[model samples]
Structure formats: structure tokens, C-alpha cells
Target chain A: MNDTLMTDESRLRREHHKGHYDRETVYRILDENPFCHLAFVQQGQPVVIPTMQWRVGDMVYWHGSSKSRIAHGSDSAKVCLTASRIDGLVLARSAFEHTVNFESVVVIGEAQRFEDTAQKTALLESFFDHLFPGRWDALRAMTASELKATAVMGLPLHSASAKIRRGPPNEPEEDRATPVWGGVLPIAMQFGKPLPDEFNQMPEPGYLARLRTKP
Target chain B: MNDTLMTDESRLRREHHKGHYDRETVYRILDENPFCHLAFVQQGQPVVIPTMQWRVGDMVYWHGSSKSRIAHGSDSAKVCLTASRIDGLVLARSAFEHTVNFESVVVIGEAQRFEDTAQKTALLESFFDHLFPGRWDALRAMTASELKATAVMGLPLHSASAKIRRGPPNEPEEDRATPVWGGVLPIAMQFGKPLPDEFNQMPEPGYLARLRTKP
Candidate 1:
């Protein structure tokens, strides 16, 4: 994708050096993070809702209850979806220079709902398979009524940008000599041992090992 | 706060049982999560940006570079601020019953900038004190230039609501008997060992211990 195609809104205004318009950087962040916060206009006011999101090729998809306001309001409307992962906290010698190491992507596009049940079901299956590998085939199949009550919306990844910050804190040369203990405290999301429900009778699936390997 | 004062826009249209308008629930979620995604209308389009936020009494505040669009665009505008923490992944016998256990708050209000340097400076100081306890005083004082380059905005918590989902997944009785391993995979954010910067010598502060105890 050409960098020029990226809109000015998607570009990072303050820290331009941290902005990335390339597909590789943008897609990597989106693929690694499954949760996203979606923003859209509702009754002339901005509203944001957190939901699970998955990406297929150049499109990003999210699902919600068919009767939910988010699904209805975002369909065919311009919206912004952001996914971020905090990697660490940078402690600087001074409070003003303190920041967090993170990777975030902002995608601005027109959201369109997948009205076709067959296509939506396929996408939903892909989502489960993508996150849990072989788990989709292990569970009971989705009923038509269940599928009918879900709304799946997709947005093209045409206007997307990634902003990333890593490594040590950026401090002034003078402050670096100060006797303050400045450094980075790494942060990560970890999955605990599988907790089986009371009614469950089967052993934990091998696909769960994938969660431990996720970035 | 009177429940009737909450506008229809702020009320949850579906699954009302999971919605909470009480101050205790809303404030607790806001206080627990420091990161938030702020949404506001910009140039007739919705924009969402992730930022670090802090809560003080009845309001939530966030700071950004003075020159950043988010700082300017959000000032005096109707915005939505959301903070969420994912506790676990709920695996059900059927795909349709899968969900996540999380605590989230959505606050809708007008954002106003704190223009006075002294007030903004004090608020910024409190933010550090709130997050790091006594570390604010150990760092170098904020310079006048740094103060002028930052913009701080606050929004009232009157129009906020918290949505919490916890415990086991809700599955059909028949599906519960399926031989599929159904349970919750607990998810948590962990802080790793701190890495000190290559600077002058100073022992790691006692405040670092507080990070490990955070929820």
C-alpha cells in the first residue's frame, strides 16, 4: 500500500517518527491484539464500545448482538477502531518525560454489516479458528437462530496507521546524569491454567497451549 | 445520583441486568484501569485515541501534548471515555455462548481543558502521586516550558455507567453436558522485573513494590 493513500487524520501529529503507514506494521498489531475499542457517532454524539475483533485479509470484523445500538449505528457509517497493547512503562528522571511503551493501530473506515448469514457464519467460524486454532471444530455448531441474532460488521483496512514506542525513556543529557533510578518496567498479559466448568467432562484441548505463546 | 437523570443514550439498551449506574461500581472500574480510549467527533467524523487517564473524585482527566489534535479536538466537545480490564476468556460448550469476563466503564460528558498553569500542574502532580505514591517528589520539578506544552482535560462522572461480566459462561443445560472442556481462561496483566536505565546510581524506589500489588 502506498503511504500517500493514508489520510492526514490517521497520521500521528505529535510524534510523527512513531507513525507507520505500511501494511506490515499495521496488520501485525491488529492480528496480535484481539480486543478493540470502536468509536462511532450516535445521535450526533460520539460513543465508544469495547468488543472482540478479528482481521481477515484487508478487512477487520467485529460482532455484536443484533439488537444492540452499536451494531445498528455503526453500519455503513464512518468509524474509527483502535487496538493497542501496552508493552512496558518507561520511568524517566522527570515526570514530563515519562511514557509507556506500546503498539497501537487506528483504522478509519466506513463500516458495513455482513447481511448474508452464510458469509457471516463463515467469518464467525474463521474468528474462532483464528483465536483458538482447532477449538471451532470441537464445539457444537451454531444454530440458525443464534446466527440470526448476531450482527457482524466489517471495515476495510485502507486507512490505517500504527504507532509504536519501545526501549528506554527519552531523557535529556543533563537529566541522565541525575541520581534518579530511571528504567523500564515491562508489562505483559499472561493466561493462567485452564479452569474447567463444573459440568465439563472432557480433558482440556491441546489448542490452549497456543494462548501461552501469544504475544 | 438519581437513576432517572441518566439519559437514554447512556443507558444500556440490551442486557440491562449487566448495566450499573451506581457510583461505587463506576468509580471502582475507573480507578482500577489507568488506560482509556477517548472518543470525540472531529471534522464530522468520530476519532478514538488511547491515552492514560486518572480519576479524582467526580471527574476523570487525561493529558496530551498541547499541539496534538486529540488535545484540541476534545476540548469542550461531547466525548465518550471508556476503560476496560479483561479478566478471563469464557469458553462455553457452544460458540454462541462464548464470552469474556471483564469490567468496563463508559463515561459520556463534555470535556473541558484546565487552562490555569498552577491548577494543571497540581493535577498533573496528583496524577503521578496517585499512580506512583511518593515518586512524584523524587523527580525533578516540571519546567515552565514543559507545563506550557501539555494540555489537560477533565470530564464529569455524572453520566457514567459500568458493565461487568464475571464468573462462568451461561450455556444451555443440554450443551453443558457435552464432552467439551468448558471453562474460563483467566487473563491478567503482570509486571516483570524492572530494568534500570544506564544512568547515575540510585537504588530502586520502594514505590516499585506497589506496582506488583496492583490489581
Candidate 2:
């Protein structure tokens, strides 16, 4: 079972237009994407880093080196977590009118570093399983030292917002008559055939067929 | 003619990794996606915002209010820009081993706001045309005062990094022996029929067909 459920909100404002507080849309996007961009400052300089992340309910978690410049010595802080999925390319007759349809989430809140052993262990398990299910359980549990060395942080979706733009171009009236190519270039993410890691010993049957039946 | 070119070494480093740096691969992902996540700090806290962006050669530009919290009063000076594409979902025989294949870029650098009249005018033209070509030239130019009110910023592709995880699950030797299902769930982005703005009067062919040719 995954903890990445979305919290519900009924009164989403217009500016916050696509801000979905619903679990269905939120979890669907979160689960389909594995990486997220995190922004924070170090010594007054803004820096953005890309890292693997897992979502638990409305909260997101990620890890980095404790000695890293951005997280190591900073005071308690709030940072932004964003996940976006690009749907298509919007080409207009005029070069100036291109646009794209997309879905994205912006989370603004404080991130709390996980220090306790029990919580860290649980989070690690949740994260690993979230990334590669059952792998965590099959592997040896994290030793006390490994847990101590890793830095894990969690940020809640307090000021969370999501934006999505879809469909075609909104060209001006008369300009539509201009002779130019216009339309969407649909794009997709497709999976290549799976290759087993070198360390794997067993000659197993393909797993691709299995994934379809389960989800 | 596109302004978003990636040439800075640092930006390239931050964006290109061993398995993900091929130009054809990078550009394929870049041209197809429309939205990016901007990470910055406000009042000692990190805030991530989702916004529309365009790539023109090496530089990526984003626009917003001059008095906005994340941009106008940003403390770190530099900002982090990230874009990610989720290719497919992985479902392994074991529930704990699910994963996804993805491509992503993390950009780190200082953002210089556009203030010069000439630069602002050019940038605005690029911005407008980048989103909707020919529209800038066709529409009335922004008055001096109107230009003064808009804020634009440029972040070089310096100190960037790109990390990508692709292909299928690396199932454990033991799990491979299990009969449970496993495989990938592909994700794609496609454009729907274009919708003209209610206010748009003269309907030319519209911009949908032109965008369809994008990779």
C-alpha cells in the first residue's frame, strides 16, 4: 500500500485554477513520475537540484548528503517542491503563438529533516518500495550506521498548488487568416524492453505481461 | 531564432549526465515539453512555482510580475529550473518493486532581471513570439510605460545537470522466479482539438496543425 494519497479541497480559486486537492489526479501524476525538482538557497544564493522523490499522502520526501551545501548548515527552512508533466507542443501559424499543454504541482512549505532511527527506517522503506516495490523488504534492513549517515527530509503540501493547461492555441481573430502551420505535436513516454541487472542470477520469465494485469 | 540555447558549461554539467547528455536526446525532450518548475526562496524559505517556459537555443526565459514574492524579492540571487519527463511506469512481480523511466534536467544559476528598454523590448518580442509567433509584430507594441511595468529574467544554462533513468525493472534474481505479473505502463502527451478564445473574431485555420509536426 502506498501513502501517496491527495488531500481534498472544495473551494479552489480561479488563479489557483487547476489546483487539484483531489487524490485521484494528484496520486496519478505523482506515481507516474519518479523525479522532482527541489529549490532551496544556500548562503543567500538560489539553487535548484533534481532528485528522486516519493509521495506519501500530500507530503513528499527526498534524501541528500548531510554535508551538501544546500541542506547541511541551513536554519529551519521552507522550500518549494514541483512536479510537472508536459502533454504536447502547441504550434501556431505565427511563430510567436506557440504554447504547450501540461500538468504541474507547486508545493510551498517547510521541510523537516528526519533524524530518528525508527522514522527514518519507515520512511526509507516507504520510499524504496515506492520506487521499486518489494526490493526494500527483500534486501537487508538498514544498519544503524547506514540510517545515521543518510539525510532524509519531508515537506508537507501546506501551500500546495497545481496548474494545468490543455487544448489548442488562442490566436487573435484576424491573424487566424495568416498562412501558417498550426497544431499540437503529441508526445509520449514509452517504455523500452526491460533488461535484468548483471547481478541477477535467475533466468526469469518476462515481467511486462504481469504489470498490465495488476494495475 | 529560438532564444533558449544550452551552452554554458556549468548549465550543461548540471543538465547532462553520462547516459542522458546526447544532443539529439536532450533536444528531443526539450522541444516537446512546455512547462518547467522554478525554485527560489522568499523570506528565508524555499518556494517552488510552476510556470510556462520556452527554450530558444541556449537560454530559457520565464516571465512574471516585477513585484512577485519569489522573483522580485528573491534572496538567493540564483534560481533553480527543472524540467522532467515521465516516460512509463514499471510494475514488477512484487508490489514493492515498481518504478518509472524518466528524463530530467536541473539548472542552477543566478537570474538577471531585464531592465534595459532595448533588452526588454527584444525579450518581450521573443517571449511573445516564443509562445505565439507573429503575434508580437502584429499587435501594437507595448507603450513605454507598459514595458516598464513588465518583469523578465534570464538564467544561463551554466552549472546545470541532467539525470535520466530509463528502460525496465532490474528485478531481483529471486523475484524473477515468481509468477506474479510485471512490465511497463507507457505515458504520453497529445494535443486535443484547439479551442479559439471566445473573443477571437476572424477564424483563420488556427495553430493546431502546425504544432503537430513537433517531435
Using DockQ as the measure, the top candidate is 1
lDDT (10s digit) by residue, model 1, range B1-215? 45432567788888888899888788888888898999988777788988988988788999989998767854347999999989999999898999999999999988888999899988998788877888888888899999999999999877877899999889879898766789999999888888888774788777777786676
Please report the TM-score between candidate 2 and the true structure.
Answer: 0.65
Per-residue lDDT of B1-215 in model 2, one digit per residue for the tens? 32333434324322134344444555555555546677776667676766655666666677765555445766656677767666676645554455556776666677878788898778767765654555555554456765665677777654555557666676666766554444555654444445544344444443445554444
User: Per-prediction fnat values?
Assistant: 0.83, 0.33
Model number with the top TM-score: 1
lDDT of 1 by residue, A6-37 (tens): 67767676698898888888888999999899
At residue A67, give the lDDT of candidate 1.
97
Off by over 4 Å in 2: A1-14, A21-28, A66-71, A92-97, A131-133, A143-145, A171-175, A202-215, B1-35, B51-60, B64-77, B83-107, B115-151, B156-215
Where's the lowest-lDDT run of ten residues in candidate 2 chain A?
A2-11
lDDT (Cα, tens digit) per residue for candidate 2, span A151-199: 8888875555556777777566665665444455555444444455434
- After TM-score superposition, the amount by which residue B85's alpha carbon in candidate 1 deviates from its true location, in angstroms, is 0.3
